[model samples]
Target: MASPARSLNPTPPLKGSFPLDHFGECKAFRIDYLKCLKERDGAQYECRDVAQRYLQCRMDAGLMEKEEMSKLGYTKSNSNRRRVSQDSYKKSKESKGFIAGLSK
Candidate 1:
């Protein structure tokens, strides 16, 4: 028997603009961001978010200060994680308190 055909829809690559500062210390992070640009099957992942996360990691590691990050436009996430935490959040508000609780 023949195998099922796969969908032909291809994913597009994600691109990020240049660093907020060109000749500043944070420019190094820009290089690191591009180096780790998520690429697979000729498509790139959203670079900014990933880059910011990596930037945050650097900050936590004491390699970069929060001020430097802010100068480079890498502040805290403006998004609400809880809203996108699961597929059910989009389904209904009932999922608000709906959780699998612990047992005795």
Candidate 2:
């Protein structure tokens, strides 16, 4: 007797796709992390700050679920602290007339 034929359909992609950053809510931070990874020759540890910011932005914007974020090492308190530090850094740079690669 002949064996039953196997199904030939390909598996469907995930509902929304992986690497939620495609939603664009946190594209800038995602790009920064990508650039950092390239600069560091793919040393993920060297890009932790940028990675964290990208993850935090996705979480804040609801593009990614909190559980998923936590699974990837995100913490609410850590994000809050990083936000404050980033804000201060931007303020200091602005005071020095620096605006995203332009300085007077």
Candidate 3:
């Protein structure tokens, strides 16, 4: 069997974008992208994975601008704080597949 550890190469783009009905919503992952993902998937998902899939699903969507994920924190260069994996961070940024978002 292949390793689930093996990263998922991105396939074709999903056919959706962030909704406008949330005219008052925030643009960051927690609000905008989370709504997008929940609408895409019937069930709710965590922000990290949803954000990753969003960047994957939409080919032209802007990448997360923050240098560090709010969840994962910083790296060894961040000597003052505990370190985390940059590679893992990048991998998280990558999308696996469009597991949902099929209903629209």
Cα lDDT tens digits, model 3, 1-104, are 86677778977545334444243223454466657656756333323465554444332343323233333432334432221454454355555433345632
Clashing pairs in 2: none
Q: In candidate 3, how many Å is residue 101 off?
A: 41
What is the lDDT for 101 in model 1? Answer: 78
Best by TM-score: 2
After superposing candidate 3 on the true structure, give the runs of residues whose Cα lies further than 4 Å from its correct spot. 1-32, 36-46, 60-104
Q: Native-vs-model 1 lDDT?
A: 0.52
- Model 3 lowest lDDT segment of ten: 74-83
Off by over 4 Å in 2: 1-23, 67-71, 74-104
Candidate 2 positional error at 70, Å: 6.0
Give the per-residue lDDT digits (tens) of candidate 2, residues 6-104. 999888665454555555888899889999999987866557778888877876887766546566766667667776787688688878775466655
Q: How are the candidates ranked when ordered by TM-score, highest leading?
A: 2, 1, 3
Q: Give the Å shift of residue 11 in candidate 1.
A: 43
State how far residue 77 of model 2 sits from its true place (Å): 14
Score residue 96 of candidate 2 by CA lDDT: 75
Best by lDDT: 2
Residue 49 alpha-carbon offset, candidate 2, angstroms: 1.4
Distance (Å) between predicted and true CA of 42, model 1?
A: 9.3
For each candidate in turn, the TM-score is 0.29, 0.49, 0.19
